[model samples]
Target chain A: MKCEQISELLPDYLQGSLSPDQRRTVETHLEQCADCSEEVAIWQKLSLLPVEQPGPASRARFEAVLQAYQAGRSNQPAHNSQWRKRFSSWNVFHWLRSPLGAAAWSAALLAIGIFAGLRLAGPKPPSPDLAAMQSELANMKQLVVLSMLQQQSASARLEGVTWSTRDQQLDPRVLSALLHTLRYDPSVDVRLAALDALSRHSAQPQVRSSVVSALQEQQSPLVQVALIDQLVEWHDRDARPHLEKLRQSPNLNPAVRQRADRAISKLN
Target chain B: MTLAPDEDLMLQVRDGAGEMLGVLFDRYQTPLFNFYSKLTGDRTLSEDLVQEVFLRILKYRQSYRPGTPFRAWIYQIARNARVDHFRKFPRQTALEPEMLPPVVPSDSAQEQQEVELLRRALRMLPEDKREILLLCRFQELKYEEIAALLGCELNTVRTRIHRALQELRKSFHQLTKGTAS
Candidate 1:
């Protein structure tokens, strides 16, 4: 067999898919050709190379992404139904149709309001189980928020940021996801919502530093102003340099620059 | 009967059975990781790319055509994920030893040296040739299947693989020569 023809068959030969006759021909050519023999040896060694095992972190990251996707899928319908159930229970039109019922309902609401005021005045503290339940619920809300923040829809991401404000207790993942949204979310509304959510967690040192770090990267004037306000409120002196940079940036929005200027002086 | 095919699992995922993707992920995660690892020689980046590929599959599941080969479709996504990653991080093309698996006590010195040389030589090959070679030799994909995945003729795939092997041979020779010197 000609070397040219043998070269064409080399791929199949290496794969062991070549016919016996073809393999014999290529082997015959290799016996006489030093270069072709070397080529075959190279491929033989190449095919024997070991596969690398991915680190455990790879699987963890994949599971995280898959779980986020699955959570987003499952909750999409649940979210719609929850709002439906909430509004469906209002029955305002039915209440208006019956004046007696409306009066009774109003009296009940007044009594509940007075009772709630008394409870507030007495400062009834939550039991341990209740506090634990609330904490678990907060963590669940954080997961949902993190999942929604990954959605393609800007409104969904905005809702995510809004959901993060449902409880005072914050998950570190929720804080990071909020900060990520603040830094990278494409929609101005989503970023603004994230900035607002982060402000709610401003007391946490990590959240404070995240907001301070995000301040240098934020472009929108409204978000920049909001972040500057949070940093100034926190009295985060570490933000002085970034705020100074924002104040001097040529493209700094006038409103944002003013906020940054005031924030810098406050920190100083 | 053989178990439910990957295509069926993916179709289920496309049809709102999102958890079915777990099956696909378990099946393809390692292959996809090895694919990226071979292409970039960066384990961490390869893992990220594997995750990105699965995410893309989920995101674009609606576009999957029934009766198409699931392996090819997934591999196509894998290739695109690697390209997109490189596009985003252009300066990360240089292969680092950090990507190589940690040496075990059982491995011989010569074996490790040969593996290192092979890796360096593979890295020296042009990107397309290296990818085709890896797909064929390492991933064990048939040339015809690759042709279908790449939207090219079978002969084109065969010729590309052949030439890629030749180029790799030249690279291996040069690398070994450099080592000897």
Candidate 2:
């Protein structure tokens, strides 16, 4: 039989699924045909390529990811997320329909009316010390972020990280808080969000350094991927050595290791 | 006693036996890692994708049904994870000579040289052909499973495998002759 004729049987033959008669036919062909025999030989030789094991840390990384996934799952039940949303909105409507809600609504309206009356009928308090008031409002926003960052719920902490990104200039304390969250947040979601928020502030030298440090300290693969991506986005060549160090680290998550290698290449 | 089948373990995991995933992970990680590393020539990416496959298994565990073959199902997920990753991070660097796996020490110089040529020849195949070859040869996926995983007919899978071998054989022969000359 020609090589073409036997080629049809060769794949099945390699798989050891051939009928005895077909197997003999291919074996006869292989003995005569060097090209076809080489193909079989090459397939056999493929096993010579050693099997590489994932680094020792792979399981630990999976544990971390699984824990984070389950924690996220518990907070918002999987498959019932839309149901939870509808239920919460219905609860809000029910609360608003209560007598207590009506009274509170009435009091808020009355207070708004009296405040308007006082503002229009009384003196205007000399322009309200505009700059100081604005500064105080900024302080208030940062304070909310700080408190939110300390919240026990990962979602609230995630929101806190989001809130931190709304300001053009960050308070030192809030910046440090975000850095800490990026480094040590128990929840990978919160840590990723913290990284996202801090990514926009790379103009700050401190932001760059802390992120590089986080690249080393983060055990979660997701956050580590984000950190390296951020450094690459910023085109920070100084991160090269840090990435190398990370790539060299024992038990580093494989995803992060890949990103670091990619980032190092891009920055170079 | 026989070990719990992957399908049953996966069903338990689906039914909320989270610990069962550890068994699945341990059984599959090395083969899956080799699958990715050989395909992409990137060990780190391969390892990461292995983790991704498990995470996705957890996320989509509900989709798994009682009769579904767990190996086929997981390979389906594995293929998607890799596709999704590349879709997100497009390939930037083509594999260079420097990027090949370090040549493993072998019993004979000729074997070592042939191994080096084979790696280069395999790398030279277009990714789709390379992938089909890897799925069958390295991954040990059966033709029927590959057909289903690739969403193609069984015969097509066989034909593709044959064609991939032809391409591989031609490349390997040419490389060997070039080195000989």
Candidate 3:
């Protein structure tokens, strides 16, 4: 057999997966083919490379991160530091007791009543530019979602994620912001919500790739598992490697690994 | 007593058992260190990257699900961590051939020389070829797993490996023949 034919079987042969006859044929070819024989020899000898140990401080660093992670989790609510700063001086009880606050509360109630009255009113008379008005409303809502996604408060950001899901077609700007939130949001809850919102738009290639990339960057096991399930639901054969890579991480939660494995199998 | 599997320990880590990560750190730091060290030929950077990989695990423990192999999942992180680091701070220095070292000094002088020549040859291949070889040969990733990791077909992976090996053989032969002359 020509080397081309033998090359087809060589990788499997090297892996020791070949049948006896095929293996013998390859072995015979090897006796006459110095280059092929030498290739196998080189492969066998690669094990000669030494495995090196990391410096001792490696464990200490890991310990620090683990401790910090737990400590941070314990103090998580407090760490929405930006929002906390804004809310700090505005004590709820103090504000409620103040005359100025009482006046402000009355004004808020009056505004709510007015808004409700407008909402309850029947649809406006047909206008010359109803499409323009609808587009303006959509732009306003998307602007709200984009701003809320950046809010210092996790719940508001989560609500922003929830609001995003209501739109059948996400504005590109809103979609990118949701993708950003999915990847970098400090709160796992908000990130998961963003993932849930974006998962609805898998028909968009951007959504699929962002979710796959998030599989690498995402820290929440719940979100990770959900991402894996979404990929499987889409039958995204492209996501198999990302899932496989996810399973390969040494620091993985076993549950997420199992989910990635199952997703890979299902996709396969 | 049987040691708990890495995956189970990871599950523990995910569920607020922060100390469980220490066990994993102990288990993986060396293999990961060697992977980066060999691939990049920079021991200091490799050590830093290994530390970074574990830190990411702690941060992303919620990302770990139970159904996959823990080793593969961590490798996924390890690969990304390295890629991201290089992306942010691209390497200015090309890898040094001598960096692929401590070739075990055995009794056969000729064998040691051959090993030395082989390391240089391995280093000489293009970055991707060297990486694929490292992932399969050194890291022990199965072909299917490599195919997934590389985002290529299984046959493409096989052909690439064969071509990589072919290149290594040619280089080693040339290096060896040069030494003989």
Candidate 4:
């Protein structure tokens, strides 16, 4: 074997995963090459070194997190309020919690109802100004959704992603926000929700590329599977390289690996 | 009937049996801490990262698919937590001998010196090399799994591991020469 080939196989050789033929080739190379032999010895010695053991405090910290998680889980009221407090603006309860806010919101709704009734009564042909007003309203909603999506709270982020899907036309800003969430959101559900929101815009080349690149960055298996499924459904040949990469990874979820393999074959 | 695996247990956690995560926490806390401890060379920080990882797992449990492997999923979270910590504390060095607790004690005088040299060599290597080495040698992850977790090709991971070890050896030799001088 050439030195480059031998070097490539050295990790597997140490791992005892090399095929007999491959192992024999490496063994022969090492026998004749003094440099390679010394290198192999170094790897062997390094492998035998002991791992640093974590102290009891590590377990103590884990249990504390576990207790907090369990506590949050068991107390149903806190869970609802916790989500509400973080995303109150996205929910009606936030406005209703204060009578003044509720009264102002009610007045605004009544005014909008009166305006809509007047527009319907006029029965005029669609005007450019009204269209502009409607588009402006959509932009405002998209802005709210994008801002909500950027919130640190996962539930609030989820609310933002869900809201984004309701828009008939996605603003470029909304699309970018969704892509960011898909790539970097701390919560898997938020990422998945971002995927759902982005799936609607997948026909756009920019959205397609963003979603494809996210496949490489996403570690959550559920999100990975969802990305694979969307790519396959979209027949996005651009996803071929990313799918192949995932296919070659040994630690991938078996089901995800299978899906990736199938996606690669289909895309090919 | 065969018992459910970690993935199933995680799915249960995903499905609202939040208490089930305790089992996983007990199972992975040490391995996870050891991974961070080796990677960062800081026991206290490693513990904090471990805690952060579990908390993320709980917070994101709803997104855990039933059939996906839990180990890969959890490690992915751990990797993210570590990466975030590194980004947040960019000024911190990865592996400092003073911060790193000693490994298992060596008996013979020469053996102790060799072990110390090896440890110093490991800590001196760049973060990426040290990380790959730790994953392969200490974490016991197969190259393929590491590849998957890292979102890279298996050959890429294997080559990286080979190169990492070579760099480590060079560092070890340099340290030994400096000591001899």
Query: Top TM-score: which candidate number?
Result: 3
Q: Put the candidates in DockQ order, highest first.
A: 2, 3, 1, 4
The TM-score obtained for chain B of candidate 2 when compared with the true chain B: 0.92
Q: Which residue segments of model 4 deviate by more than 4 Å?
A: A77-131, A134-136, A139-268, B1-4, B92-108
Residue A88 C-alpha lDDT in model 4: 54
Which 10 residues in a row give candidate 2 chain A its minimum summed lDDT?
A: A78-87
Clashes of 3: 32
Q: Candidate 2 residues A1-268, lDDT tens each?
A: 9988888888899999999999999999999999889889888888777778889988887877666555444554443323223335454455445554455455555655655555577576335554544565566567667866876556556667888989888899999999999888776657867888888888899999999888777766656766787787777889999999999999875555655787888788
- Lowest summed-lDDT stretch of 10 residues in model 3 chain B? B98-107
Model 4, A109-188: lDDT tens per residue? 66566558658877783687577656655655775676677655577678878988887788888888888988988765
> What does candidate 3's lDDT look like per residue over A81-176, in tens digits?
233233343544444445644654555556556455555664773454455555656766676667667666675676678878889999999999
Using TM-score as the measure, name the better of candidate 2 and candidate 4: 4
Q: Model 3 Cα displacement at A185 (Å)? A: 12
lDDT of 3 by residue, B1-32 (tens): 99999999998887677788889888888888
Candidate 1 deviant stretches above 4 angstroms = A78-268, B96-108
lDDT of 1 by residue, B1-181 (tens): 8878999998888776777888888888888888888887778668767866887786667679899889888898887877765553465246554455644434568777777778877887887888888788777788888988778998898789878878887877776676666
Q: Would candidate 4 be rated incorrect, acceptable, medium or high by CAPRI criteria?
A: acceptable
Docking class of 2: acceptable
Candidate 2 similarity to native, TM-score: 0.59
Which of candidates 2 and 3 reaches a greater DockQ?
2
List TM-scores for all candidates, in order.
0.56, 0.59, 0.62, 0.60
lDDT of 1 at B18: 73
Which pairs clash in the backbone of model 2?
none
Per-residue lDDT value at A252 in model 1: 65
